[model samples]
Target chain A: MSETMKAAIFVKPGEMTVREVPKARIEQVGDAVVRVVRACVCGSDLWYFRGLSAHPHNSQIGHEAIGVVDEVADAVTSVRPGDFVVLPFPYSCGTCPVCRAGFESVCPHGGYFGASQAEYVRVPEADGTVVKVPGSPEDYDDETLASLLTIADVMSTGYHAAVSAEVRPGDTAVVMGDGAVGLCGVLSARMLGAGRIIAMSRHEDRAALAREFGATDIVAERDQAAVDRVLSMTGGYGADAVLECVGSRQSFDTALGLIRRGGVIGRVGLPHDVEISAEGTFYGNIGIKGGPAPVRHYDLEAGLLDAVLERRIDPGRVFTGIYDLDQIQAAYEAMDRREVIKSLIRF
Target chain B: MSETMKAAIFVKPGEMTVREVPKARIEQVGDAVVRVVRACVCGSDLWYFRGLSAHPHNSQIGHEAIGVVDEVADAVTSVRPGDFVVLPFPYSCGTCPVCRAGFESVCPHGGYFGASQAEYVRVPEADGTVVKVPGSPEDYDDETLASLLTIADVMSTGYHAAVSAEVRPGDTAVVMGDGAVGLCGVLSARMLGAGRIIAMSRHEDRAALAREFGATDIVAERDQAAVDRVLSMTGGYGADAVLECVGSRQSFDTALGLIRRGGVIGRVGLPHDVEISAEGTFYGNIGIKGGPAPVRHYDLEAGLLDAVLERRIDPGRVFTGIYDLDQIQAAYEAMDRREVIKSLIRF
Candidate 1:
């Protein structure tokens, strides 16, 4: 086997490079090393790429991946070598209080994967973090593999939005962003039994996808206009639940204005400079439930993988552009310019 | 038969006077005139007394009362003259979308009972706002009347905190204030099936009341000490639900620190200059649900009145002082000095 691997490393603002790096090895009793099959870019990555947020120079990049396990330490009992697995964005000790409570993403002992966008990656807490696929990666078609990759992040995140909002059967729900997560939020709301789904998107392509994902209405307006449109659509009562996929001040303000008096806002966009007034939420009996998506919980505990294998949801459509490991820069650039909804990296 | 009556008027900060004013009468088709039987000074009333919040120079003061229906417009059918009723702080139109959804406090057509502290109060949307007691106020003893008076505000507000927190059976709950509402929150958490109740209070009198109201433990420490104590008590996992009866920034901070991952904070103290970071909440999968308590919903719709009459809960114990209408100034002064948990005015 080769002692070196191709990996993407963060160089600085607006730059990432693919270079030959040391192959991942089992470093702890709980660690496992996997040869990457697929990985993808995330919207949050743009925060650092645009210099809106800082990224450490020369750090291993990427957090989402699916691969075939090549090595596992003795303590890693969940998966063995040659096993196909999908990694949740963050690794967790499944026995921790937080993971036990189904909030694995925030487990104190857990953290993000830093080298998933590489030929070989080391996974800590492997027994608790990675979900084993039913069969080898080659058994799945390209579309199915793409869909499985979503289970690592976006799809689970969208489902978290719906779950957090407490979307009820036959209730009106709204999605506040037109990105991959927002589109997936529409799909999740539908699966959760929302009777009427409204997707607020200005992009035609995204809007069409939202409709396909079960949105009953499309709102192209922005800010207060969007709030007014939703209110008008719901007979001035507003939606019962709102999925805030864009963690912007304007998005939160719009959410505050466009929900029914007793509604909730499920925010999963990784907030950027967002401050919510306690007084503002108190008057409306509004609820705010959000955070990092517990992808491991959704994938293993909530049967998300089963739903995917059954073809119940095809979230891979968000992967509009595919690239080889060498095209890492182009992938980030295309997503930053909104040229593609998301970019998938094939190993 | 009286054309004029004495009402407490807000003269300025630290000054309230009983002055002769026109007696309350039907002002709208949905109005009812309530002859005050018992009214109380609330913690919120102290906000203006301390000059911390603004009030009109001579507006009728107070928002909580239990009274006998003196007169009603022809269109008011819920209560008739001579019927005893508990006035929820806000009067809401039952038909409004907000009211239908059980949030009467923020109904578009609802408002506070400004003259509730007076000899008579003109209640608008009476049918939707007042919950009729089985008989006249004379039929119940002083203790029952005092408890019923609490159904108007504090007790219901406390219940809102527990309900908002989604306290479940066997869960450990924390109450963040030692005021009447927080004490009642202890009772509410117990009623909601929380196995362990921790009250964060400093005063001996309030702590005693909290225990009587079903607090299993009390943490007299403030700020970080309180947070640390709670974390230690719950095996370092923190409480499952925290009732934020104090809407200060410090209380919210403490709540954020002491809640277990996936836990919730139910705040109902009428937030004063409080702000929550969305990023902070998102990481822990924390949820915030709060607002003005929907008293009418709890009283009529949820059978809180039944619980009071059945003696299942006696929240009246929070009334540590009682005074005649003529002693209004002393009532406010005693409460302002923290000499009483709550002061009741008997008319």
Candidate 2:
């Protein structure tokens, strides 16, 4: 085993570099070292790279990945060396109160894995953090593998949005954003039995993928125009549930405009400068609910892994571009340019 | 009956005068004129009186009341003349889409009853707007009548808060105001099976009433101190659900600080100047759901009317002071001075 391994390192705004770094080891009683098999860029990663938000220079940059367990500490028993696993972004002590309440992402004993986009990643609380796959990495094909990778973040996030919105069986669900999460939101709404899934996207490619994922309608408009179009379509009643995937003020406002009285908004995008006035929401009887995806909770609840493994959804189609460790910078650049819906990096 | 009757009129900021105004009569096909038997001042009414918010000069005031049906249009059949009833603040058509969804408060065809404190109130959509109390006013005692009056607004609003917060058995529920609505919220939480109900109050009288309303604990501290006390009380985990009965920024912020991860906030107070950041709520996996109470929904669903009639709750005790129509100004002043938790006006 090598003492050093290649990893993606944040250099500065708009740049990430792949270089050899110290290999991860079992540092705690419950730690496990997983050799990366797949990793992906998140929309939030683009935000950090664009400096819309700050990121520490030289910090390990990724938070989603799938890998094979290389080692586990003596106290870790959930998985063993050679076991294939899916790593949720946040490492949590699943026994904590927050975790017990199905919010492991915000568990007091949990923290993010900022270094998942690397050759080897140290997973703390391994017994609670790494989800063991039924077989080794080769047990699934490339598409299945990519779909499994999404269970770490985007897909689960989309599912969370749908769940938070309380999407009903015959609801008219409006999804804002054309990104991977939004497409998955379409899939999730469909999975949850939404009668009408409307995808708000201008990009033809993303819109098509959204349809494939289960969008019954597509509105290529933005802001108030989109709101008008949707309201007109629904007899001026607006949607029953709105999945807000873009966390900008405008997106939030658009969401507010696109819901019927007593409708709900499930917001999954990490909000950037959005302020919801309680008075503004009072008259409409609007309900706002969502947060960072508790991917682990879903994994344990309904099994996103099983859904992918069983081919119930083909979310891997979101990876319009793929790359290797050497092409890390290009992956970020391609996604930043919107040249790809998402970039999946192979180990 | 006289063509004119005494009513409370909003003369201007800080002045509400009782004067002879034209008595209400059936104005629409769905209308019913109710002779006021009992009416009360709401905290929001105080807000209107204090000029914190605008109300047209010389306009009719008051929305909570119980009365006898004086007359009903040919199109109305829910209640006949001489039938006792509780009038919800908003008069909604029974069949509107929003009304059918249980949010009659924001029904497009619905509107406020600004003249309820007067001699007679013309309730539109009488079949839907007026909840028949089974018999005439003489059948119930004064306490039951007062509690029935609360069903028109405060009690239902408080119950909506608990329902929105998704209060569960064995959960710690926090009520964020000491006013009538908050007191009712404490009672509502207990009704919903909350094992621990914490009422945030500093007033000795209100605190005692909160205890009587099933508040197992009381935190007189405000802001950070209150948050700290609650955190310590629950082993620094905070309450599972927070009912925000005060819509001020401080109250909302305190509610945020007092909830555990995955906790929810149910806000019913008419929000003043509160702005909630999506970013602030995202990290905690928090949920917010509340609006103007769908009082009619509660009335139709679990029968808040039945709850009062059955003595399952004694929310009428929230009326700490009572007055006649001539003391209308004094009723407002008493609540403003914190000398009374709430005031009821007898016709």
Candidate 3:
């Protein structure tokens, strides 16, 4: 293996370029090195590109990718060389108390799965962080690989939102967002047996994908008007539960208002400037929960992977654009312009 | 049957005095007049006497009492003249959607039982707001009646804190206040089958009551140290659930830090300067719920009142000071100075 490899780095605002950086190795007790096969551009990736978050000066970027295990430390188990695997975003030691409790995304000794938009990634706690693909990575086409990438982050997050909100059979649910994660929330709510899924979407293309994923209705209204539509739709009460796929002050407040006397708002979107009225939530008996999705813990087990493999649900339909790994910059720009739902990058 | 009556009002900060005011009349179709027999000083009552909340100039102040029905409107079907009852703190009409969903505290037409501190109160939505105390007003003694008074607010609120947190058998519950409500929380935790109850109490006397009320342990430690102790006790995790009975910033944050993954925090204390990190809660799988307790919905049927009436629990022991109605000023001063746990006023 070469000592150096190409990796994507964020140089300045709205500018990303690739450069040769030191390649990853099996340094830790449970580490494994994997050769990248596919990576995906996330809506949250724009947070830094748009100057909404702390910028990294020539620092590695990206956290979702699928790969083939190339090397492993002696302590690493459950994965071997040449095995296809899905890299869990935000590496976690599965044996830790927090991970055992199912919050693998915030494992105490864990760190982000950054620099995965490169030739290889050194995943810590490899036995816990890497899930083996059922077959050879070459068996799946590029689009199918992109679909598998969703399992590492967005799809698992949507399932977390649905499960946290306690979306049950015969229940009606409302999803707040039109991004890839929100569309996946529509799929998850349907899979959870939600009788009706109402998605709060503004764009037509994503709205179409939401319907393809089983969204029964789409309301483009925002703020109080959106709350009004939801209330009126459920006979002036509201949906049985709400999936806060958009983590904004306005979206959080609207989700709070949309629930009836007692309902839960499952949130997975990263939050900023989130000020909540304790009194407002108390009176409505609304329960808000969700953080980072323990995607690795859920991926193959939550029926998402099998459903995708069996062609039961088309989670890959979220990919509206595709590019080579060197074209990551253009891919992000297109997504930022809302020209594509999401972009897939082949390694 | 003359119109004039003596009532307690907040004449000014640090000055709660009794004065002659117009007596309550059956003004609405669902209104009923109650002649107060026993009223207790709530720790929250000092919100104004201590100059915390907006002090109303000569306005009604109390919201918890056991009283006799002096008169009733035609629509008052549940109680009649001479019937003794427990008045729900938030007067709910019991027919609103929120009320039907079992949260009467936030009923659209509801208001606080403010005039209960005085000799009489006009209860709106009489059938829905008043619960018959299972006997005549002359049946129970002053102390038992005072105990019944806890059903209206404090005990119900404590039960709310426990229930909202989903206190299950064999679970560890931590109460965050040492006042009347906090003491009641200790009792309620036991009733809910909590195997161990830890109270955050510093005062020896209050701690004694907490122990008597079923607190298995007392941790006078505050802030991070308290959280550390709780985490250490639970094997580096934290308590299964926490009851936030003191709503200050420090206590709120401490309670937030004292729960293990997937634990719930039930809060009932009036909050000020409370800030929560959304990221912190989501990552921990923590759910927080509690506001105004729907005492009306829980009083007669949730088994709180029956538990007390059956002598299975004594919520009235929270009263460590006894005074006549004329000694209301002394009552307020004692609570403010921490001289008494709580005070009961007999008419």
Best-matching candidate per DockQ = 2
**Which of candidates 1 and 3 reaches a greater lDDT?**
1
Candidate 1, backbone clash total: 1
Categorize the docking of model 1: medium
lDDT of 2 by residue, B1-347 (tens): 55898999888988878999788887889989999999999999988888898889998899999999999999997789999999999888878667777888888788888788998888999987888888799999999999999999999999999998989999999999999999999999999999999999999999999998899998989999999999999888889999999999999999999899888899998887887767778888889999989898897786788889999888999998999999998999899999999999998
Across B292-336, the per-residue lDDT of candidate 3 in tens digits comes to 888977776688878878878899989899888778889889999
Candidate 3 per-residue lDDT, tens place, A1-347, comes to: 56998888888779888899999887888899999998888888889888888866899888988989999999987989999988878788787656765677777678678778888888888887887888888898766777788888898889889988879887889999989999999999999999999999989999988998999999999999999999999888787789998888889988987887667788988887776677677666677777788787777556677776777777877889998878879988999999999888888
TM-score of 2: 0.96
TM-score against native, each model? 0.95, 0.96, 0.88
Q: Write the per-residue lDDT of candidate 1 for residues B222-262, one digit (tens) a residue.
A: 88998899999988889989999988888889999999988
User: After best superposition, candidate 2 residue A257: deviation in angstroms?
Assistant: 1.1
Q: Which regions of candidate 2 deviate over 4 angstroms?
A: B12-14
Greater lDDT among 1 and 2 belongs to: 1
Error of 2 at A112 (Å): 1.5
* Fnat per candidate: 0.92, 0.86, 0.46
**TM-score of the second chain, cand. 2:** 0.97
